[model samples]
Target: MRDLLAITKAIADESRLRAVGLLDGRELCLCQIVEVLGLAPSTVSRHMAILGQARLVESRKQGRWAYFRLTEDDAPAEVHDALAMVLASLKRDKQAKADQKTLKAVLKIEPEELCRRQSDCKC
Candidate 1:
Protein backbone atom coordinates (compact mmCIF):
# COMPACT_ATOMS: atom_id res chain seq x y z
CA MET A 1 0.00 0.00 0.00
CA ARG A 2 2.74 2.44 0.86
CA ASP A 3 4.56 1.66 -2.36
CA LEU A 4 1.39 2.19 -4.35
CA LEU A 5 0.79 5.50 -2.62
CA ALA A 6 4.29 6.68 -3.37
CA ILE A 7 4.10 5.70 -7.02
CA THR A 8 0.79 7.48 -7.48
CA LYS A 9 2.03 10.61 -5.78
CA ALA A 10 5.31 10.67 -7.66
CA ILE A 11 3.58 10.59 -11.04
CA ALA A 12 0.73 12.94 -10.13
CA ASP A 13 2.30 16.07 -11.53
CA GLU A 14 2.58 16.86 -15.23
CA SER A 15 6.29 17.54 -15.05
CA ARG A 16 7.04 14.31 -13.30
CA LEU A 17 4.90 12.36 -15.73
CA ARG A 18 6.74 13.92 -18.63
CA ALA A 19 10.01 13.10 -16.92
CA VAL A 20 8.97 9.47 -16.75
CA GLY A 21 7.87 9.53 -20.35
CA LEU A 22 11.21 10.97 -21.35
CA LEU A 23 12.95 8.13 -19.55
CA ASP A 24 10.91 5.31 -21.05
CA GLY A 25 13.67 3.48 -22.87
CA ARG A 26 16.87 5.33 -22.14
CA GLU A 27 19.05 6.78 -19.43
CA LEU A 28 19.33 10.56 -19.30
CA CYS A 29 21.70 12.99 -17.70
CA LEU A 30 20.12 15.34 -15.20
CA CYS A 31 20.86 18.21 -17.53
CA GLN A 32 19.08 16.46 -20.37
CA ILE A 33 16.00 16.12 -18.25
CA VAL A 34 16.25 19.76 -17.22
CA GLU A 35 16.55 20.83 -20.84
CA VAL A 36 13.54 18.78 -21.88
CA LEU A 37 11.37 19.80 -18.96
CA GLY A 38 12.65 23.37 -19.03
CA LEU A 39 12.64 23.33 -15.26
CA ALA A 40 15.32 24.35 -12.83
CA PRO A 41 17.91 21.67 -12.12
CA SER A 42 16.98 21.68 -8.45
CA THR A 43 13.31 21.27 -9.28
CA VAL A 44 13.93 18.35 -11.63
CA SER A 45 16.28 16.83 -9.08
CA ARG A 46 13.55 16.84 -6.49
CA HIS A 47 11.06 15.35 -8.89
CA MET A 48 13.47 12.58 -9.82
CA ALA A 49 14.12 11.90 -6.16
CA ILE A 50 10.42 11.37 -5.61
CA LEU A 51 10.26 9.00 -8.55
CA GLY A 52 13.27 7.17 -7.18
CA GLN A 53 11.57 6.78 -3.83
CA ALA A 54 8.66 5.19 -5.62
CA ARG A 55 11.04 2.68 -7.25
CA LEU A 56 9.87 3.89 -10.61
CA VAL A 57 13.34 4.99 -11.62
CA GLU A 58 16.99 4.29 -10.83
CA SER A 59 19.92 6.68 -10.84
CA ARG A 60 23.67 6.71 -10.66
CA LYS A 61 26.34 9.36 -10.63
CA GLN A 62 29.19 9.15 -13.08
CA GLY A 63 31.82 11.68 -12.11
CA ARG A 64 29.91 14.95 -11.65
CA TRP A 65 27.05 13.90 -13.87
CA ALA A 66 23.85 12.25 -12.65
CA TYR A 67 21.99 9.85 -14.91
CA PHE A 68 18.48 8.47 -14.47
CA ARG A 69 16.62 5.62 -16.11
CA LEU A 70 13.41 3.72 -15.62
CA THR A 71 13.66 0.78 -13.29
CA GLU A 72 14.51 -2.52 -14.92
CA ASP A 73 12.79 -5.91 -14.92
CA ASP A 74 14.26 -6.77 -11.54
CA ALA A 75 12.12 -4.14 -9.88
CA PRO A 76 9.08 -5.23 -7.90
CA ALA A 77 5.92 -6.19 -9.75
CA GLU A 78 4.05 -3.11 -8.61
CA VAL A 79 6.68 -0.86 -10.07
CA HIS A 80 6.64 -2.71 -13.37
CA ASP A 81 2.89 -2.44 -13.57
CA ALA A 82 2.90 1.24 -12.76
CA LEU A 83 5.54 1.94 -15.35
CA ALA A 84 3.70 0.01 -18.01
CA MET A 85 0.53 1.96 -17.29
CA VAL A 86 2.31 5.29 -17.33
CA LEU A 87 4.15 4.59 -20.55
CA ALA A 88 1.07 3.27 -22.29
CA SER A 89 -0.94 6.30 -21.27
CA LEU A 90 1.79 8.63 -22.44
CA LYS A 91 2.05 6.92 -25.83
CA ARG A 92 -0.76 9.02 -27.30
CA ASP A 93 -0.25 12.23 -25.37
CA LYS A 94 0.51 15.31 -27.46
CA GLN A 95 2.86 16.71 -24.88
CA ALA A 96 4.80 13.46 -24.76
CA LYS A 97 5.27 13.58 -28.54
CA ALA A 98 6.49 17.15 -28.32
CA ASP A 99 8.85 16.22 -25.55
CA GLN A 100 10.32 13.41 -27.65
CA LYS A 101 11.10 15.92 -30.38
CA THR A 102 12.66 18.30 -27.89
CA LEU A 103 14.63 15.47 -26.34
CA LYS A 104 16.04 14.58 -29.76
CA ALA A 105 17.48 18.07 -30.06
CA VAL A 106 18.77 17.97 -26.54
CA LEU A 107 20.43 14.61 -27.18
CA LYS A 108 22.26 16.01 -30.18
CA ILE A 109 24.20 18.34 -27.86
CA GLU A 110 27.09 16.87 -25.92
CA PRO A 111 26.36 16.34 -22.24
CA GLU A 112 29.26 18.53 -21.11
CA GLU A 113 28.16 21.35 -23.38
CA LEU A 114 24.59 20.98 -22.17
CA CYS A 115 25.72 21.27 -18.56
CA ARG A 116 27.87 24.28 -19.42
CA ARG A 117 24.95 25.96 -21.17
CA GLN A 118 22.69 25.30 -18.24
CA SER A 119 25.22 26.72 -15.82
CA ASP A 120 25.26 29.88 -17.90
CA CYS A 121 21.52 30.36 -17.44
CA LYS A 122 20.51 33.31 -15.25
CA CYS A 123 17.84 31.21 -13.62
Candidate 2:
Protein backbone atom coordinates (compact mmCIF):
# COMPACT_ATOMS: atom_id res chain seq x y z
CA MET A 1 0.00 0.00 0.00
CA ARG A 2 2.85 2.35 0.78
CA ASP A 3 4.45 1.65 -2.55
CA LEU A 4 1.21 2.14 -4.37
CA LEU A 5 0.64 5.48 -2.72
CA ALA A 6 4.20 6.54 -3.35
CA ILE A 7 3.98 5.59 -6.98
CA THR A 8 0.74 7.43 -7.44
CA LYS A 9 2.21 10.40 -5.62
CA ALA A 10 5.21 10.42 -7.91
CA ILE A 11 3.02 10.42 -10.98
CA ALA A 12 0.57 12.80 -9.41
CA ASP A 13 2.56 15.84 -10.39
CA GLU A 14 1.20 17.61 -13.45
CA SER A 15 4.58 17.53 -15.13
CA ARG A 16 5.09 13.82 -14.65
CA LEU A 17 1.52 13.17 -15.62
CA ARG A 18 2.07 15.12 -18.81
CA ALA A 19 5.19 13.12 -19.53
CA VAL A 20 3.29 9.85 -19.16
CA GLY A 21 0.51 11.09 -21.35
CA LEU A 22 3.01 12.10 -24.01
CA LEU A 23 4.55 8.64 -24.20
CA ASP A 24 1.48 6.60 -23.38
CA GLY A 25 1.57 4.37 -26.42
CA ARG A 26 4.44 5.51 -28.58
CA GLU A 27 8.03 4.69 -27.75
CA LEU A 28 10.01 7.89 -27.26
CA CYS A 29 13.68 8.65 -26.87
CA LEU A 30 14.94 10.95 -24.18
CA CYS A 31 15.65 13.72 -26.61
CA GLN A 32 12.15 13.60 -28.03
CA ILE A 33 10.81 13.67 -24.48
CA VAL A 34 12.99 16.65 -23.75
CA GLU A 35 11.64 18.33 -26.85
CA VAL A 36 8.10 17.50 -25.83
CA LEU A 37 8.31 18.03 -22.08
CA GLY A 38 10.59 21.05 -22.27
CA LEU A 39 12.20 19.62 -19.16
CA ALA A 40 15.85 18.76 -18.63
CA PRO A 41 17.03 15.19 -19.15
CA SER A 42 17.74 14.77 -15.45
CA THR A 43 14.25 15.79 -14.48
CA VAL A 44 12.78 13.45 -17.05
CA SER A 45 14.94 10.63 -15.79
CA ARG A 46 13.61 11.07 -12.30
CA HIS A 47 10.07 10.97 -13.61
CA MET A 48 10.87 7.77 -15.48
CA ALA A 49 12.37 6.24 -12.36
CA ILE A 50 9.24 6.83 -10.38
CA LEU A 51 7.04 5.63 -13.20
CA GLY A 52 9.14 2.49 -13.65
CA GLN A 53 9.12 1.73 -9.94
CA ALA A 54 5.36 1.92 -10.18
CA ARG A 55 5.38 -0.45 -13.17
CA LEU A 56 3.48 2.09 -15.16
CA VAL A 57 6.25 2.55 -17.75
CA GLU A 58 9.05 0.46 -19.14
CA SER A 59 12.43 1.39 -20.57
CA ARG A 60 14.30 -0.11 -23.50
CA LYS A 61 17.98 0.45 -24.14
CA GLN A 62 19.46 0.16 -27.62
CA GLY A 63 23.03 1.26 -28.25
CA ARG A 64 23.10 4.84 -27.02
CA TRP A 65 19.38 5.28 -27.19
CA ALA A 66 16.89 4.44 -24.48
CA TYR A 67 13.25 4.44 -25.35
CA PHE A 68 10.38 4.52 -22.89
CA ARG A 69 6.92 3.10 -23.30
CA LEU A 70 3.76 2.56 -21.30
CA THR A 71 3.34 -0.84 -19.68
CA GLU A 72 0.45 -3.00 -18.53
CA ASP A 73 1.90 -4.52 -15.43
CA ASP A 74 1.35 -4.41 -11.68
CA ALA A 75 -0.96 -1.44 -11.69
CA PRO A 76 -4.43 -1.60 -10.28
CA ALA A 77 -7.19 -1.92 -12.82
CA GLU A 78 -8.18 1.62 -11.97
CA VAL A 79 -4.84 2.88 -13.19
CA HIS A 80 -5.45 1.26 -16.55
CA ASP A 81 -8.91 2.74 -16.76
CA ALA A 82 -7.54 6.11 -15.75
CA LEU A 83 -4.84 5.90 -18.40
CA ALA A 84 -7.35 4.93 -21.04
CA MET A 85 -9.62 7.79 -20.17
CA VAL A 86 -6.66 10.12 -20.13
CA LEU A 87 -5.51 8.96 -23.54
CA ALA A 88 -8.94 9.49 -24.92
CA SER A 89 -9.33 12.86 -23.26
CA LEU A 90 -5.67 13.84 -23.41
CA LYS A 91 -5.81 15.16 -26.95
CA ARG A 92 -7.86 18.04 -25.74
CA ASP A 93 -5.35 19.07 -23.09
CA LYS A 94 -3.53 22.34 -23.58
CA GLN A 95 -0.15 20.85 -22.65
CA ALA A 96 -0.50 17.88 -24.97
CA LYS A 97 -1.75 20.16 -27.71
CA ALA A 98 1.27 22.38 -27.24
CA ASP A 99 3.60 19.40 -27.16
CA GLN A 100 2.34 18.25 -30.57
CA LYS A 101 2.98 21.70 -31.95
CA THR A 102 6.55 21.62 -30.70
CA LEU A 103 7.15 18.14 -32.14
CA LYS A 104 5.91 19.24 -35.55
CA ALA A 105 8.21 22.22 -35.45
CA VAL A 106 11.13 19.94 -34.58
CA LEU A 107 10.44 17.68 -37.60
CA LYS A 108 11.70 20.33 -40.03
CA ILE A 109 15.39 19.86 -39.23
CA GLU A 110 17.92 18.38 -41.68
CA PRO A 111 19.17 14.84 -41.15
CA GLU A 112 22.56 15.67 -39.71
CA GLU A 113 21.15 18.50 -37.75
CA LEU A 114 18.30 16.36 -36.53
CA CYS A 115 20.67 13.64 -35.39
CA ARG A 116 22.92 16.18 -33.76
CA ARG A 117 19.95 17.94 -32.26
CA GLN A 118 18.13 14.76 -31.37
CA SER A 119 21.38 13.22 -30.04
CA ASP A 120 19.40 10.31 -28.57
CA CYS A 121 20.75 11.05 -25.11
CA LYS A 122 18.51 8.33 -23.69
CA CYS A 123 17.49 10.56 -20.88
Candidate 3:
Protein backbone atom coordinates (compact mmCIF):
# COMPACT_ATOMS: atom_id res chain seq x y z
CA MET A 1 0.00 0.00 0.00
CA ARG A 2 2.77 2.38 0.85
CA ASP A 3 4.57 1.59 -2.37
CA LEU A 4 1.41 2.14 -4.42
CA LEU A 5 0.82 5.44 -2.70
CA ALA A 6 4.38 6.47 -3.42
CA ILE A 7 4.03 5.54 -7.07
CA THR A 8 0.82 7.53 -7.34
CA LYS A 9 2.40 10.58 -5.76
CA ALA A 10 5.65 10.24 -7.73
CA ILE A 11 3.78 10.37 -11.03
CA ALA A 12 1.30 13.07 -10.04
CA ASP A 13 3.28 15.98 -11.45
CA GLU A 14 3.56 17.00 -15.10
CA SER A 15 7.32 17.52 -14.94
CA ARG A 16 7.90 14.14 -13.37
CA LEU A 17 5.66 12.43 -15.91
CA ARG A 18 7.55 14.10 -18.71
CA ALA A 19 10.80 12.94 -17.15
CA VAL A 20 9.51 9.40 -17.14
CA GLY A 21 8.43 9.70 -20.76
CA LEU A 22 11.91 10.85 -21.71
CA LEU A 23 13.37 7.75 -20.07
CA ASP A 24 11.44 5.25 -22.16
CA GLY A 25 13.38 2.73 -24.30
CA ARG A 26 16.79 3.89 -23.08
CA GLU A 27 18.93 4.70 -20.15
CA LEU A 28 20.00 8.36 -20.01
CA CYS A 29 22.48 10.48 -18.19
CA LEU A 30 21.00 12.82 -15.61
CA CYS A 31 22.23 15.75 -17.63
CA GLN A 32 20.62 14.30 -20.75
CA ILE A 33 17.25 14.25 -19.01
CA VAL A 34 17.82 17.78 -17.76
CA GLU A 35 18.46 18.91 -21.30
CA VAL A 36 15.35 17.23 -22.71
CA LEU A 37 13.12 18.64 -19.97
CA GLY A 38 15.00 21.97 -19.81
CA LEU A 39 14.58 21.95 -16.08
CA ALA A 40 17.16 22.87 -13.49
CA PRO A 41 19.42 19.94 -12.65
CA SER A 42 18.44 20.08 -8.99
CA THR A 43 14.73 19.98 -9.79
CA VAL A 44 15.10 17.04 -12.15
CA SER A 45 17.26 15.26 -9.61
CA ARG A 46 14.58 15.62 -6.97
CA HIS A 47 11.93 14.37 -9.37
CA MET A 48 14.06 11.36 -10.24
CA ALA A 49 14.62 10.66 -6.59
CA ILE A 50 10.87 10.46 -6.09
CA LEU A 51 10.52 8.09 -8.99
CA GLY A 52 13.33 6.01 -7.58
CA GLN A 53 11.55 5.83 -4.24
CA ALA A 54 8.51 4.48 -6.03
CA ARG A 55 10.67 1.86 -7.78
CA LEU A 56 9.54 3.24 -11.14
CA VAL A 57 13.16 3.90 -12.10
CA GLU A 58 16.61 2.66 -11.25
CA SER A 59 19.80 4.68 -11.21
CA ARG A 60 23.53 4.15 -10.97
CA LYS A 61 26.61 6.28 -10.76
CA GLN A 62 29.43 5.77 -13.21
CA GLY A 63 32.44 7.93 -12.43
CA ARG A 64 31.06 11.46 -12.08
CA TRP A 65 27.92 10.65 -14.06
CA ALA A 66 24.52 9.33 -13.05
CA TYR A 67 22.30 7.35 -15.38
CA PHE A 68 18.66 6.35 -15.02
CA ARG A 69 16.46 3.72 -16.61
CA LEU A 70 13.04 2.22 -16.14
CA THR A 71 12.92 -0.70 -13.75
CA GLU A 72 13.31 -4.11 -15.39
CA ASP A 73 11.00 -7.15 -15.67
CA ASP A 74 11.68 -8.21 -12.11
CA ALA A 75 9.81 -5.19 -10.76
CA PRO A 76 6.51 -5.62 -8.98
CA ALA A 77 3.42 -6.14 -11.12
CA GLU A 78 1.99 -2.83 -10.00
CA VAL A 79 5.10 -1.05 -11.21
CA HIS A 80 4.91 -2.70 -14.64
CA ASP A 81 1.22 -1.76 -14.86
CA ALA A 82 1.88 1.84 -13.91
CA LEU A 83 4.73 2.12 -16.41
CA ALA A 84 2.52 0.72 -19.18
CA MET A 85 -0.16 3.30 -18.46
CA VAL A 86 2.31 6.17 -18.45
CA LEU A 87 4.07 5.02 -21.61
CA ALA A 88 0.76 4.49 -23.43
CA SER A 89 -0.54 7.89 -22.39
CA LEU A 90 2.70 9.48 -23.51
CA LYS A 91 2.41 7.79 -26.92
CA ARG A 92 -0.49 10.11 -27.80
CA ASP A 93 0.89 13.22 -26.07
CA LYS A 94 2.12 16.09 -28.20
CA GLN A 95 4.48 17.26 -25.51
CA ALA A 96 5.98 13.82 -25.16
CA LYS A 97 6.59 13.63 -28.90
CA ALA A 98 8.24 17.03 -28.83
CA ASP A 99 10.40 15.97 -25.95
CA GLN A 100 11.41 12.88 -27.84
CA LYS A 101 12.50 15.06 -30.74
CA THR A 102 14.46 17.19 -28.32
CA LEU A 103 15.90 14.10 -26.72
CA LYS A 104 17.21 12.89 -30.05
CA ALA A 105 19.14 16.10 -30.41
CA VAL A 106 20.32 15.96 -26.85
CA LEU A 107 21.57 12.42 -27.29
CA LYS A 108 23.89 13.59 -30.02
CA ILE A 109 25.81 15.75 -27.58
CA GLU A 110 28.49 13.95 -25.58
CA PRO A 111 27.44 13.49 -21.97
CA GLU A 112 30.43 15.47 -20.71
CA GLU A 113 29.67 18.33 -23.08
CA LEU A 114 26.01 18.21 -22.13
CA CYS A 115 26.79 18.33 -18.44
CA ARG A 116 29.10 21.27 -19.04
CA ARG A 117 26.23 23.17 -20.65
CA GLN A 118 24.00 22.86 -17.61
CA SER A 119 24.58 25.75 -15.19
CA ASP A 120 23.58 23.75 -12.13
CA CYS A 121 25.34 20.53 -12.98
CA LYS A 122 27.25 19.18 -10.02
CA CYS A 123 29.39 17.03 -12.28
Candidate 4:
Protein backbone atom coordinates (compact mmCIF):
# COMPACT_ATOMS: atom_id res chain seq x y z
CA MET A 1 0.00 0.00 0.00
CA ARG A 2 2.82 2.39 0.85
CA ASP A 3 4.61 1.49 -2.34
CA LEU A 4 1.51 2.14 -4.34
CA LEU A 5 1.18 5.54 -2.71
CA ALA A 6 4.75 6.38 -3.53
CA ILE A 7 4.17 5.45 -7.16
CA THR A 8 1.08 7.58 -7.24
CA LYS A 9 2.96 10.49 -5.72
CA ALA A 10 5.63 10.21 -8.34
CA ILE A 11 3.08 10.27 -11.11
CA ALA A 12 0.95 12.90 -9.43
CA ASP A 13 2.58 15.70 -11.34
CA GLU A 14 0.68 16.75 -14.47
CA SER A 15 3.82 16.69 -16.61
CA ARG A 16 4.63 13.18 -15.55
CA LEU A 17 1.08 12.04 -16.19
CA ARG A 18 1.15 13.61 -19.62
CA ALA A 19 4.40 11.82 -20.34
CA VAL A 20 2.90 8.56 -19.22
CA GLY A 21 -0.20 9.11 -21.31
CA LEU A 22 1.90 9.71 -24.40
CA LEU A 23 3.65 6.44 -23.74
CA ASP A 24 0.32 4.74 -24.38
CA GLY A 25 0.63 4.21 -28.12
CA ARG A 26 4.31 4.39 -28.92
CA GLU A 27 7.86 4.37 -27.63
CA LEU A 28 9.47 7.82 -27.52
CA CYS A 29 13.05 8.98 -27.51
CA LEU A 30 14.19 11.35 -24.81
CA CYS A 31 14.56 14.11 -27.37
CA GLN A 32 11.04 13.52 -28.60
CA ILE A 33 9.63 13.45 -25.14
CA VAL A 34 11.52 16.57 -24.13
CA GLU A 35 10.19 18.37 -27.17
CA VAL A 36 6.65 17.21 -26.48
CA LEU A 37 6.79 18.33 -22.90
CA GLY A 38 8.83 21.44 -23.70
CA LEU A 39 11.02 20.80 -20.72
CA ALA A 40 14.73 20.78 -20.20
CA PRO A 41 16.38 17.47 -20.94
CA SER A 42 17.42 17.13 -17.33
CA THR A 43 13.96 18.03 -16.10
CA VAL A 44 12.31 15.54 -18.40
CA SER A 45 14.91 12.95 -17.49
CA ARG A 46 14.26 13.53 -13.81
CA HIS A 47 10.53 13.06 -14.24
CA MET A 48 11.25 9.93 -16.20
CA ALA A 49 13.53 8.72 -13.44
CA ILE A 50 10.72 9.15 -10.94
CA LEU A 51 8.38 7.23 -13.20
CA GLY A 52 11.03 4.60 -13.84
CA GLN A 53 11.69 4.23 -10.13
CA ALA A 54 7.99 3.87 -9.42
CA ARG A 55 7.68 1.13 -12.03
CA LEU A 56 5.40 3.29 -14.10
CA VAL A 57 7.69 3.50 -17.11
CA GLU A 58 10.73 1.78 -18.63
CA SER A 59 13.77 3.04 -20.46
CA ARG A 60 16.33 1.73 -22.92
CA LYS A 61 19.28 3.35 -24.57
CA GLN A 62 19.67 3.40 -28.34
CA GLY A 63 22.71 4.99 -29.92
CA ARG A 64 22.71 8.46 -28.39
CA TRP A 65 19.13 8.49 -27.26
CA ALA A 66 17.24 7.09 -24.33
CA TYR A 67 13.87 5.73 -25.33
CA PHE A 68 10.91 5.14 -23.07
CA ARG A 69 7.82 2.95 -23.19
CA LEU A 70 5.20 1.22 -21.13
CA THR A 71 6.68 -2.16 -20.38
CA GLU A 72 5.18 -5.30 -18.86
CA ASP A 73 7.48 -5.30 -15.85
CA ASP A 74 6.88 -1.64 -15.07
CA ALA A 75 3.67 -2.28 -13.17
CA PRO A 76 1.43 -5.01 -11.92
CA ALA A 77 -1.46 -6.15 -14.08
CA GLU A 78 -4.10 -4.33 -12.08
CA VAL A 79 -2.09 -1.17 -11.57
CA HIS A 80 -1.10 -0.87 -15.21
CA ASP A 81 -4.62 -1.64 -16.29
CA ALA A 82 -6.02 0.95 -13.93
CA LEU A 83 -3.60 3.65 -15.03
CA ALA A 84 -4.50 2.93 -18.63
CA MET A 85 -8.15 3.32 -17.88
CA VAL A 86 -7.54 6.52 -15.96
CA LEU A 87 -5.53 8.00 -18.79
CA ALA A 88 -8.22 7.14 -21.30
CA SER A 89 -10.96 8.44 -19.06
CA LEU A 90 -9.42 11.85 -18.55
CA LYS A 91 -10.62 14.77 -20.64
CA ARG A 92 -8.07 16.06 -23.12
CA ASP A 93 -8.34 19.84 -23.11
CA LYS A 94 -7.69 22.16 -26.01
CA GLN A 95 -4.17 22.82 -24.76
CA ALA A 96 -3.44 19.14 -24.49
CA LYS A 97 -4.81 18.54 -27.97
CA ALA A 98 -2.68 21.33 -29.31
CA ASP A 99 0.35 20.05 -27.52
CA GLN A 100 -0.20 16.59 -28.97
CA LYS A 101 -0.48 18.06 -32.42
CA THR A 102 2.76 19.98 -31.93
CA LEU A 103 4.47 16.84 -30.72
CA LYS A 104 3.36 14.99 -33.83
CA ALA A 105 4.82 17.70 -35.99
CA VAL A 106 8.16 17.60 -34.22
CA LEU A 107 8.20 13.81 -34.42
CA LYS A 108 8.04 13.98 -38.17
CA ILE A 109 11.43 15.71 -38.29
CA GLU A 110 14.82 14.08 -38.29
CA PRO A 111 16.90 13.71 -35.17
CA GLU A 112 19.31 16.28 -36.49
CA GLU A 113 16.50 18.75 -36.80
CA LEU A 114 15.38 17.91 -33.32
CA CYS A 115 18.86 18.36 -31.92
CA ARG A 116 19.25 21.63 -33.76
CA ARG A 117 15.96 22.92 -32.46
CA GLN A 118 16.93 21.98 -28.92
CA SER A 119 20.53 23.09 -29.07
CA ASP A 120 19.94 26.37 -27.28
CA CYS A 121 16.70 25.64 -25.52
CA LYS A 122 17.22 25.76 -21.79
CA CYS A 123 13.81 24.26 -21.20
* Top-lDDT structure, candidate number: 3
- RMSD of every prediction: 2.2, 3.3, 0.7, 2.8
Give lDDT tens digits, candidate 3, residues 1-123.
998999999999999999899989899999999998889999999999999999999999999999999999988999999999999999999999999999989989999998889998977
What's model 3's lDDT at 74?
Answer: 85
True lDDT of residue 14, candidate 1: 96
Model 3 regions more than 4 Å off: none
Q: What tens-digit string does per-residue lDDT give for candidate 1 at 3-118?
A: 99999999899999999999988999999999999988888999999999999999998888899999988888999998999999999999999999999999999888887778
Best by TM-score: 3
lDDT of each: 0.92, 0.69, 0.94, 0.74
Query: Residue 116 in candidate 3 has what lDDT?
Result: 86
Query: Candidate 2 residues 10-111, lDDT tens each?
Result: 567787777777786677776676667777667778888887776777888877666788876667775676567666777889888887677667645433
> Predictions ranked by lDDT, top down?
3, 1, 4, 2
Q: How many Å off is the CA of 86 in candidate 1? A: 0.6
Model 2 TM-score is: 0.75
Question: Which candidate, 1 or 3, would have the higher TM-score against the true structure?
Answer: 3
Candidate 1 residue-wise lDDT at 74:
87
* Regions of candidate 4 where Cα sits further than 4 Å from its true position: 120-123
